[model samples]
Target: MSSAMFARDVPFERSPTTDLPVLLPPRPRERFGWPKLTTRHALLFAALVLVAAGAAFAQAPDAPPAPASEALTTAPATPLSVVVKWAPLLLKGFIFNIVISVAAMTLGTITGLMLGLGQISQNTIVRRLSWFFTQFFRNSPWLVLLFFAMFMIPFQVRIFGTTIPLPDWMKAIVGFALPVMANVSELLRGAIRSIPSGQWEAAESLAFSRTKTIWQIILPQCVKRMLPPWMNLYSLITMATVLASIVGVGEMLTLTAQVHAAEGGRPELFAPLYGFAGLCFFLYCYPISKLTQRLERRYNVKT
Candidate 1:
């Protein structure tokens, strides 16, 4: 064939009519209709709608004044100032709560340790009594126990010729401690049970007494297991201390409510005040939770 004929046979040299349209891979099908709405998108849309509705409500002249104590109130223009003004008083109450939590936890832990050891006693009476103690406190509602402690426990006792008076706060602590002690006893029981049976056998071969074996060998090993749960329980107890308000303990929530009332029962202050209280609690509890997790990981204990 001549050079011109060869040129015509080149792949690019087909007749225009014979040429196929160069179709670029259909432009990825243009994901038509609407974009798939994700949780994030839905939330954002909902938030925008809420904001618009709020703005519209705010602008409505004929809207009735909201009851301060009833609804989720609108914040005042100066929320920061309100927080700053009330924060000092709230801090003092929060400190009181801390004191109660710490005191209750300390007493509870000591009592719980004794009860836990009692649960595993060889004697039937001791074991049954310990079980009874645990069940009684564990099953009882905290509020009921609080009321019992408040009402049943005497206000005064003559000890060594001194009339010692039990105040409401002290009584509240005793009430809180009962539940804490019970739960801690369970924690101890579980931890002790978790130890390998061979360890008990080994202790026996060494001629260790039951008490000695527990105190010296078994308990030392169980400490790591018990620690995470103990800390977690303390955190729970700390949260529950808010219930002390029922007995007039004057903790953070109680004082916050008082402060809210004192601030003219302004509907707007509700969120900021309560939100601040919540933030305080979160600050306290979150670190504890994180610490518990870390201890759990470090000890390789799931509890």
Candidate 2:
């Protein structure tokens, strides 16, 4: 009985014709260098060798001088020296750019606050007037506005027998401020509109006047929504200050051009000096952009 049970439990071998799944081994991780160099590795190695050879040739003492005519026609070859010599002046001009942007933005923000509120005024005339102002400034090309402020605005104003002449930089600032005001007004209007009707109803239930409700309750909430856009606008305006050079505002670009010319317009200096100017703008604007993005995300505001 024990021998019979063992034979039954052991079972029989499978028939040769029976089909079974084939189990393949996992693929070996493809390697790159030496004995196992792949197409990708070959290409990368070739590129690296070419770069090394080029660098060695460049540093070699026997390297030939550039043709005199080519050298003369091109920008300065030594940009670092030029930048070193002119850095102070460029920095001064950059400071002016900063000052102008800040002043224009400040003025624009104050004016925009009033214009935005006026757009929602109970009186039809006030609303229309605000809309007209916003559209006029918004639709006008910035260059044209700059030209108008530079030329059409009277240079001298007589107040109590006192005559004052507006400087070119001041006119540029005012020109820039108009567009900023229009944009900020739109931002404010949108932020206010974004609040739920429930908020307005709640304020009204508290017996608050419209102005009081806006100032005390509504605007406080809108601040979070408005701040990110406000910072974004400032960055744009900061970059736009470069345009002031067209009107001879003596800003960084203007100084760069002057320095480049002073440096004999050498081809080598062209990239370095201009690149330095661009770097300055980048350094100034990049942080603002990052901050704006962070604030927008934190407040869950889209603009």
Candidate 3:
């Protein structure tokens, strides 16, 4: 082929004025469509909708005005003032809820890690027992578990001649942790199983012990796969902390009710106070959920 033909086929274009090859800028990657709508945006939109609905309901027509003397004597406190005054107390209870969630998650994760390993063990008895407990707790209702923990567990126990108090909140933590442990166990089992069997065979070929293979090779790979789901589970646990209130643990919802009663039980304050509690939870969990999504995308593996 002539040099002229090779020149004509060159990737770069020749400069018209100087007769020298000009390098073209690389083409930009094409994006397919509109920007993705994220979870945060969806949450904010839902919050706005709730706010609008609450405002409309608050402005709904009221009963006819009371007699002037009665109205002057019985005027209820403004809803804004009531919420603002009680927000700090409500926040303390909310912090307690966060503490319960963190404790439960920690306890659950540690226990679940052991259970997950058990499920994958070569011994038949250990595997079966781990599977049974995982299935039992995973399928049970959360509230029922809370009630069980509350009634069945003792109020206190003595160990080494020392009496230890077992408070309602501690029982509540146990209740929440049961299901979380089971779920984590399942998550881990699934993540480990998702790894290719070739990995196990390759480790065997290298004469690596099964335990060493799992710890050094298998589990490390599973971590990326497990993280996104684990974070999602944490968010769920955080939200479910509110359920502790039903069992008489003074979480945010319970405190909200007390605040309403303390503020004379004005019917108008009920919605706003509970709404405020929901908003707090939304604020805390939303970031976690957004991070989980990003991690899922970043760690996504193509088949």
Highest TM-score: which candidate? Answer: 3
Off by over 4 Å in 2: 1-77, 301-303
Instruction: Report clashes for each candidate as comma-separated counts.
Output: 0, 9, 0
TM-score of each: 0.75, 0.74, 0.81
lDDT of 1 by residue, 1-303 (tens): 675575565433345686643323333432223234479857865675455445544543453777888446654435447788989999888888888888889999899999998999999999999999999998999899989999989999998999999998999889889998999899999999999899999999999998899989999988999999898988888888889898888888999889878877766566667767866776687778877777777789543
| Model 2 agreement with the true structure over 55-112: per-residue lDDT tens digits | 5345434425778778676533344566787899999999999999999999999999
Better of 1 and 3 by lDDT: 3
Q: If ranked by lDDT, best first, what sequence of candidates would result?
A: 3, 2, 1
**TM-score rank, highest first?**
3, 1, 2
Once superposed on the true structure, which residue ranges of model 1 sit more than 4 Å away at CA? Answer: 1-77, 301-303
lDDT of 3 by residue, 1-303 (tens): 676686776668878799777867887854333345689888987887578457746854575789988997777666777788999999999999999999999999989989999999899999999999999999999999989999999999999999999999999999999998999999999989999999999999999999999999999998999899999999999999999999899989999999989976767777778888988998788778878877888789655
Candidate that beats the other on TM-score, 2 or 3, i.e. the better one: 3
Each model's lDDT: 0.81, 0.82, 0.88
Specify the poorest-scoring 10-residue window by lDDT in model 3. 28-37
Superposed Cα deviation of residue 239, candidate 3 (Å) = 0.8
Looking at model 2, report the run of 10 residues with the lowest lDDT sum. 29-38
* Candidate 2 accuracy as TM-score: 0.74
